[model samples]
Target: MDLRALTLLAGANSSGKSSVMQPLLLLKQTLHEDRYDPGPLKLDGPNVVFTDAGQFISQVAVGQRPRFEVSLGVGKDRGRLLYEPSAAGVTLSETGVSVGQAPEIIMRDGSVVSARETAVLLELPGLEAEGKNSIASRHGIAHEIPLVPWVSIAVVDGVLLKGSVEFPAVGWKTHLSNDLMRLIHLGGHRGNPSRRYPRSVSSSDLRPGVFHEQAAGVIAHWKQHDPASLDALQSAMRTVGLGWSIEPVDLDATAIDLRIGRTRETSRAARDLVSIADVGFGVSQSLPVLVALIDAKPGQLVYIEQPEIHLHPRAQVGVADLIVEASRRGARVVIETHSEIILTRIQYHVAKGTLPPKDVLVHWFACDPKTGDTTVTAVEPDAAGAFGDWPVDFAEVGERVDREYIEAAWKRQSGEAG
Candidate 1:
C-alpha cells in the first residue's frame, strides 16, 4: 500500500489493520540484525517477534506457496524484494530496481541500455550477463565489445555480454536504509504506569509499546544534552491539554526519577512537583507518545498505535494536531486508531487548509465473516471535511445508544399514561 505524508489505519478489532505494518517491522528487525548480510526477513527480533511462518502469513491458499513482498522508495527511485519462508529463516527471492527516467546510455559496441536496466544490473550481483542479453534481444542489436569501466553495455555477436557500467549514484537508498535503522514504533498495549522509570545509556530508540519503560531516561538524556527538545516536548504536552510538565530527577547513576509539575494559575503561586504515579493514568500513557514525536528527527518515520488510549475526547482531538504538526515538519507519521474524535479533527484540519488533503490518507479495514479474512478499503476526505463512502457501522454505537434511550423513554411514558 502507498503511504502519504500522514496515513491513518482505522478499523474494528481483528480487522487486519496491524497486518499492514507487520512486514515492515519485520524487515526493519531483520536488517538491523545485519544490513549487509541480513540473511532473511526476521519474524522475531528487537522490533517484533512472530511465532512462526503460519502466524506471519495472512492466508494460506491450498497448495500455494506463502510469501510476502516489501517495496520501498525515496523520491522517484524504487526497489522491491520478494521474500518466502525457509527452514532456516525468511529468504529473499527476487529483487527489482527502478530508477526514474534518465537518458539512455550508448556503449562503444552500439548497444544501448535504459536507466532502469542499468540500475538493476548495478544492484544485483552476477546479473550483468543476463541483463545485457535481455536488453540486446529486445532491441535486436549486435556488436563485439569487451566489458570496461564507465561503459554502459557491451555485446559480442548476437548475444549481449557483461560490461563495466557506471551506474548513476542514487542517495535515496542510503537514506532509506538509515531511516530503517532509526525507525520508532509504539504498540497498542504500552507499558503500564510505574513509580519510576529505569535509566539506560544504550537505549536510543523507543522500544515497541515499552516506550514508557524508557520515557524518563529519554527525557533525562535530552534534558541534559538538548534542553530545547524538552521545550518541544512540553509544548506538545500543553497542546494535548495536559497542563503538567515533565522533569527527570537523578535517583542514582543507573536510575532516574520522573516528576510531574502542576501548572499554577494566574491567582495561585507555583505548585510543588509530584511523582508521575500521582497523576492520572492518561497522562502517563501519553507522555511517551509525546516524547517520541518531539524527539523524532526530520525524515524519520514514527508509527503509533492507538495513541488515543486512556485519553479524553478533547485530548484525542488534540493528538491529531500533534500528528499534523509532526508531518508538516518532514517527519513521516503512520497512526492506527479507532477514535472518531481524532479522525474528525483530521478531517477538520484538511477542510480548513491546516493540512493539505492530498497529504492525508485513510484506510478502513473490515473482516469477512465467512472467510474470517480482513479487507481494507481506502476512504478519501473531500474539501468539505466529509468522507466519501463512509462506513455506516463505523463508530455508530453512540447513535445506537441514543435510539435505545429514546425507545425506553417512550415506553415509560406510555405505561404511566395507561
Candidate 2:
C-alpha cells in the first residue's frame, strides 16, 4: 500500500490529537522487541519523556503503563514483516511463522537466532509452540506491518507526523544531511525577520547545519531533472516565502560540502538574511518543518509536530499544501495539527479533486482532566475539509450561545426583563 503524504490528523485542544503522535514517534520504541537495543536516545523505553506545550506527557505513566494498539494494511508482503521486542533482542516474523514458535530473533549476542526451544529462551511466553502467529505481545500488537510503502513516524513537541520515507530505516541518518541544520539554526523556526547573530559574521561566513543540509538535498533533487521532486521542494519553501540556492565548498579539507545560499525573498535566503527569533513566530516555527519535508527522499518517512504553530491562517494553508505535495511524490506524510486553517486546507484540496479524500483522517481526542481518561474519535472529511457532520460540541459555539440566550429567556419569562 502506497501511503499518501497528504494525510491530516486534526482535533480540538487536549483532544488527544497530539497524543496520536506518541505512538508514531515512538514506533521503534514501542513495536520493536525488547532486545532491540533502542539506541542511546532510548526513545523506545518505558521511561521515554516527551514535552508538548510545556506539559509533560511521558510514555511511562506513574502506577500505570499507557497501552495502545496500531493497525495498518498488509500490502504485497501479506503482513509478514513484524517487530516485537522481548527480554531478548528484536524479533522478526513472516506470515508463515507461528507466534508460538521461536521468532527469527535478532539477539543482543549480535547473532540472529531461530529455533523452537530458543523461543522460550527469549522470554516470549505468548508463543505457544504451535499456534498461529499473533501480533500481540507484552506491548501493543499490530494487526499488520507491511513493506513497499515505507512507513516511519516522528513526534515533535506534541504533534505526530506519520509518513513513509524514501530511504530505508538506515538511510534516514544520512538523508537528513548536514547542510539542512545550518539553515534551521540561522533562524529557520526562530521566526526572526533579519539575521542577528549571537556573534557577528558576514552571510558568506555562515556554515551549513541541519537547515543547510535539508536545503542542499532539495537543491540536489532539483538538479536531478525530477520535476515532481523539485516541485514539491520549491512549493514548500515558496509557501513560507523563502529562497533557495546551493554552492559547493570544502569541508575539513577532505570533501566538498553542498553550501546552501539564502535570499530572504526565497525561503533559504531569508534564513541567512534574518534571525529566526526576529521573524514572525509562525515563520520561526514552520519553515524548518517545511524544509524537512521538502528534503525528505521519496521512500523515507518524516515525523513533524505542529507544523501549524505560530503560522498565520494563510501560511497554515500553505503548510497543508506542502504536505500534500510531498505525499503525491510517493512520500508518506502524517501530521498532527490543531489548526483549523490547516485542516481546512486539507479539505479544500480533497474537495477540489486535487487530492484523495481517503488518504487523510482526522482523530479527535478528548481527555477528561479529572480522570485522565482519553477517547479518540476518528473524523472523516469531505473534499472541503468539512466533516461529514460536526458532532455536538465539536466546536461548541452553539452551546455557549444557548446558555446565554436561555438565561435571558428565563428572566424575561419571569417578568424580570428590565
User: Once model 2 is optimally superposed onto the true structure by TM-score, how far is the C-alpha of residue 237 displaced, in angstroms?
Assistant: 3.5
Segments in model 2 whose C-alpha atoms lie over 4 Å from true places? 1-5, 28-36, 39-41, 44-235, 242-281, 297-299, 383-385, 392-418
lDDT of each: 0.67, 0.44
Clashes of 1: 0
lDDT of 2 by residue, 168-266 (tens): 232222222211212112121333432321221123312232232234334443455456655665556556554343332333432233433355355
Candidate 1 lDDT, 187-303, residue by residue in tens: 876666766677773355424333556667779888888889898887778778766577788887788777777774534323566777788877878887887777676677888
Native-vs-model 2 lDDT? 0.44
Per-model TM values vs. the true structure? 0.78, 0.51
